[model samples]
Target: MPDSDKLAIAAHLHVLLRRKTGRVTDTEWMAVNADYAAEVVRFARQRAQEDGVPELADWADRLDHAMHAVAPPAARRPLLDVATQAVRQRAVPAAPEPVPEAPRYVGGIR
Candidate 1:
């Protein structure tokens, strides 16, 4: 329960959010992520306090400012791919076995 731990929790929450929902299309995911980020701002302050910091809002803001400093598409493409794939793969059903049809008897008059 330290400042570092609080920051880690915030980072984890973001990653965890990203890793959910297979069919969450990129646009949908992005929108949802934006929402989560907004929510996390509030959560991060609470989390930092839970982790034993006073005035966690200030600490959370600093942590987030550093996090947001990372802003290159190339910087995040791999993470995005991993999260999307993990979700998509989990949602997909396994290939089903084909069932053979029973042989039909020809009419006796045939």
Candidate 2:
């Protein structure tokens, strides 16, 4: 599955876990979503190996969004934890960093 999708799934689970009970850190997130975490790790490895699949640099971000937990960009421990767990498992494809389409130059030329 796509790295973002994997992360989304994991994040979804994380949110559920948090809502169902109490607070959780990155470590706890890993413990809770072991399977999805493994998937994220696997995806990262594939990208590192220069595999055919698209590389997704912001898999963590996607997951964070899915989890509905918005923190500073610097604070990505939760995302990392999920990816690490996934990598420990089987291969998971990561969509490469999106080369954003050029923004529409709506402003008048200087």
Candidate 3:
């Protein structure tokens, strides 16, 4: 999955965890920190079992898998870097298309 998708999942899980367990977590950190993510996953799973909420367990499972699948920090590029490279590569900007003028009626009633 793409990094954006993974981050989205982490954000969603963060909100769910907060609402269900009153535990606040940094969504961005959770996306990159495997150890923190693992701890969150364990806590979520334990709460799921205790509260008998299968949905929470499923989310925790997803987080666990996603965290394990993430690339190492060194291998991952920051979004700012990608944007900067894109900006640098664009040598010229494209001209905007011209808009057509609408026809005007002369008579009050036709």
Model 1: which ten-residue window has the lowest total lDDT? 21-30
* Tens-digit lDDT track of model 3 for 1-110: 56677688888888888888898988888888889888988998999899887778888889889877746689889999999999888956788999898657656555
Per-model TM-score versus the true fold: 0.25, 0.25, 0.60
Give the residue spans of candidate 1 off by over 4 A. Answer: 1-34, 43-55, 71-110
Candidate 2 structure quality by residue, lDDT tens digits, 24-99: 4353454346455555445444453553322233443444344444457775568788888988765766668978
| Ten contiguous residues with the weakest lDDT in model 3 | 101-110
Considering only N, C-alpha and C atoms within 3 Å, which residue pairs clash in candidate 3? none
lDDT by residue for model 1 (37-101), tens: 45555665565566554445564464456445545666556878899999999999999999999
lDDT of each: 0.51, 0.49, 0.83
Error of 2 at 44 (Å): 24
Which one wins on TM-score?
3
- Among the numbered candidates, top lDDT falls to 3
Question: Candidate 2: global Cα-lDDT?
Answer: 0.49
lDDT of 3: 0.83
